[model samples]
Target: MTSGTADSGRVRSGLRGAAWLLPAAIVLVALNFRGPIVAPAPVIGDIRADLGMTATVAGLLTTIPVLCFALATPFASWVIARFTAERAVSLSLVIVLVGTVVRSIPHEAALLIGTAVIGIGITIGNVVIPVVIRRDTSPERVGLVTGVYTSALNIGSMTTSLGTAPIAAAWGWPIAIAVWGVLALIAAAAWTYTVGAGAAWRGSDHDSEPLPVTGPIDQVLDTGSVRTATEQRAAVIETLPHPAKRWVTWGLMLAFGGQAFSYYALTAWIPTLLHDEIGFDTASSGASSSVFQILAVVGALGVPVLANRFRPRVIIVLVAFFWLAMPLGLLIAPQLWLLWSVLGGAAQGGGITIIFIVIVRLVSNDDDARRMSAFVQGGGYLLGSAGPLVAGALHGATGGWTAPLLTVLVAVLLLGVVGSVSARKVR
Candidate 1:
């Protein structure tokens, strides 16, 4: 074989190897994103009692992260511009580590401060990772990679939520909370290596041809480094016209908000629902809640594969059914709460994956996907932040679960309508 061909082949092989490492690193980062947030929820009772915190104050521990996710996602691209995606994510891990250690100090002030810091770190990771995946992976593999990413997120959440109670019982809640920091540190290390290797690969393959830009969004992704992020945004805006006007973007946002609304509402109240409404004991209630998170991993892994193969609308309908079934089942058949929990978890995981795939498909290029993802997540999550509070209010006003379950049913119906629109083909 000719030396030129051989050199070209080696470069291709090196790029392929680096691509594999990138996904692994991405998965590790995904795992840490939710584990830290999930850990505190399972040990919240202990935290509240030990710290002498009011229920209102303790609720902020969970609410702060969701709030940050909504508020911080818009500006995530700015961070990506400042440090690059890799460095920003690695810096986020450092923030997470610091937060974990501070919260473990066994002080009320430290716990609140640390949790908010970790939330900020998680918010950046959440917004930037989709853009990273889109830029890094081949088009056909985006769905699969998203599936794995979502699955890793659910797995981390499940691990901490289930393990935290047991670990805290054996050691202490502070230690249980701090243990996840070790995983964050490990993720940061993997990301650092991935960034260094990716840079080297880019330098070596400088002669390789760039991916063809099919549209405005593709043009945005192509700006890997053309001066500042401000310039990048200005360029994207100039080319793309009106991103917000697209019906699909709005549909995607509503669907995204619907899923977030249901997930957060249930996450905040499911254990209590199991205990008070379903007649489960304290331990059983927590265990049942953990099962919901565990089963969600199954949906996260399976749904994307199905969405890729079958009609996207069919999957949306299926997700809507899951959403509808959960609240109806809880309301009508309290005896089978376990089944409802599984359905709810599956619906949440699968629904999230479906929305992500929709976002990826909605835009053909990395830039649009990044901006679209930012808007969908940023605006959607901001709208969704009210779900838990609204549900709580409904429950209080009625002094029962009926009003809350009905409220979830209305949200689920909206998900079906908006999600169906999002599943349609767009130019």
Candidate 2:
């Protein structure tokens, strides 16, 4: 009787410890979410001027981080499975801190290397946050937590995008990059304090599964189950939602991919685009891009609220119809269309938020959601990663911006089709 009591007490204490670490780790990871990617965008020109580089190289710099996003997600599933979600996320933040510090070095080589590392950190955070939420929180609250997480991610992104440029303008670019490290370190400290030294706690009502961390080697050798191993590998590549889900997944991916491509191009080069095309100064461009991002947050916030009140598909279709005009407006009416661009971005972000919210609710279990998340993002970002670079490359290759603009026009139309498909009522 005493032995059993002691074991129960130890288990109870462990769960208590995990409860604190779990949420703290989540919020900390969320803090670093957009720090690596968008924060550096505003400083692109500074780096270019310093290095005497071309626009193509600039595109490569942004492309590298996104490519990491595409690549890192597959590894994330393995990461959470092996180390567990909290540990995987905690370790990713460490990478973010280290990456930020490294980028702060005055050398161009380190900047590239550090940026990629920071992206790797963000990638893990992106993939695991959903899984952790499903595992730890109650079913009813999943949608709410998804919104909160999305909000946290956007908040981090907006801060980084807005903060980095001004800092780089005042201090050296290295200092600007390094400044974000403080947040990462603070996140790490908060996480460690909350969880103490061990993994997150498991409650009695929970069916405690292993966290989502596993490397390829672990998959091939450690698991030793050919069936589960094959499924894991496939999970990263294809989402393969059922008949009802098929169009929805493709539509979300396309709509997401389309706007994402455009947004990346716009945010990365809006200042340059306006400067080269119209005559706006850098400050004006930055302010405009910041406004666009802020509106995106508004759209993201509207997703759950609107979702609860309306059919998810109807909301999606409305957003899609609105988004169709963004690229067209940019091409035909630069003066009138910049506002359209901003509104389009917000619509896309909102659509994405609801897509994820539905995903949070629709899947049957935590593991399924994790697999679905990895597959959707992996494939989605594969398309998404290509958009910005292609736009930049088109401008470089053709010696004109018109081709890039035209490409966005085509992409915008296609994305609408996808969004329409994604708006279906199937679970």
Clashes of each: 0, 15
Stretches of model 2 off by over 4 angstroms after superposition: 1-28, 193-255
User: How well does candidate 2 match the true structure in TM-score terms?
Assistant: 0.79
**lDDT of each candidate versus the true structure:** 0.76, 0.67
Best TM-score among the predictions, by candidate number = 1
For model 2, state the Cα shift of residue 386 in Å.
1.1
Tens digit of lDDT per residue, candidate 1, span 1-427?
Answer: 6654454334432324487898898889988887776677766777878888865566666667777778887667678666776777887788788888988889988888898888788878887888777767766787888888888888888888777778888999889888888899889889888887877876776545432223454455554443544555566667764558777788888888888777777776776687787676544666678777878877888887797677777788888898788899989998888888788888878888888877777675556767788888887777666677777667767788998888888878778888887786731
Residue pairs clashing in model 1 are: none
In model 1, which runs have C-alpha deviations exceeding 4 angstroms? 1-17, 207-237, 278-283
Q: How does candidate 2 score on lDDT?
A: 0.67
Q: How high is each candidate's TM-score?
A: 0.87, 0.79
